[model samples]
Target: MPFWRHPSPSLQPLSLLLLLGTLPLLCSAATPGQLPAKRIQPLPASNLGSGRVETKGPGLYELTAERRAALETIRYAEGTWKGGSSIGYRILYGGGTFNSFERHPDTVVVKRYASAAAGAYQFLPGTWEAATRSLGLSGFGPASQDQAALHLIERRGALAELDRGVLTDQAINRLAQEWASFPTASGGSAYGQPSKSVEQLRAFHRESLRRHQLRREGAPA
Candidate 1:
């Protein structure tokens, strides 16, 4: 693979390329081999008719069709179950409200979403292709090993991209393997009170999205 090159400062990754709807994407400067589903498209208009949804902050972007969508808030989780490998839960919540990780073999790295208070989700590092039954404060589990790629979470709020980024071969296999291991676990974030009232749930997402825009646009949390 070519050396990793960051996108130009002007080439903002959070901007949306609204096709039929919205696809969140950015061509990897290192390898523009195959374009990803969440592709970065130029904003044809300087003002793309967006509101709080797209203007909040954080690295998240929204897709607008009949209505504008808050982007990147949904949390897509992937991890091991036992020695057998496992797929994690799927959840969507406001930035920094509550977020975490769990590993089985190694030490569990605790992470918090600073997106709201600090304007960015405090990221946690996971080793590729290594499984550990470790757990964190915001989240839980001494998760199993799945030999997956880097666990990816979409920027809190956008529908753009698949929402999870585990592209390398090992990561892909681990994700697929773990996803295969526990079909139900891979289904949704039914693990906690991510939502109760549908509207509140919806608002959690909306609030997250606005914050995403704000973070992206350089607003402090």
Candidate 2:
């Protein structure tokens, strides 16, 4: 048998270059039924537009594109109309925070209104209590208020239609009962002092739908 010896040290660099050159081809080769290993990449940052990123955990974020769309939609339809987080109707009506228990003086249906309409959405006391208790919501933060409003929309069975941009007048009328700003079938206030006309509500909703579609389709805001 011939004696085996190590290669010369001068050849080591050339040997390393050849091995490195073949390494890629070796790694790229796979069984007939298998695929080559894919390069793992960290996730790209979310494009949630102008909304601020809300941290949910140590590394988790909540400001996604879909979330921004929903928040914007609600802001236009509810927050903008009711009084935004700042200087919204809830505050003037003596209702802006969860702890707000002040009664609105406006009367509806010949009865003196007593429930507090608090939060950006202007949730009535009974409505907020029922919703929060049923949904197990801990507080009335922006996220919680968003969830509660969306939950009400889901209950009305209009969420799917709204998302699809096919909500009808009838659906809108029905949903309007859930909000005082919108007119009812009889064109009367469900709650006292609904300042917005039906035409205004319709226009707002139409614009909202258009904006929603724009965002969903990746068009400019």
Model 2, residue 160: C-alpha shift (Å): 3.1
My TM-score estimates for the predictions, one after another, are: 0.22, 0.52
* Whole-model lDDT values for every prediction: 0.23, 0.43
Candidate 1 Cα outliers beyond 4 Å, as residue runs: 1-102, 105-197
The numbered model that scores best in lDDT is 2
* TM-score computed on alpha carbons, candidate 2: 0.52
Q: Per-residue lDDT for 112 in model 2?
A: 27
Record all residue pairs in model 2 with backbone atoms less than 3 Å apart, i.e. clashing.
83-88, 83-89
Model 1 whole-model lDDT (C-alpha atoms): 0.23
The parts of candidate 2 lying over 4 Å away from their true place are 1-115
Give the C-alpha miss distance for residue 141 in model 1, angstroms: 12
The residue-by-residue lDDT of candidate 2 on 48-148, one tens digit each, is: 22234343323222443443343344445444444234434333223323333233222211112222345556565455555555454444555555555
Error in Å for residue 58 of model 2: 23
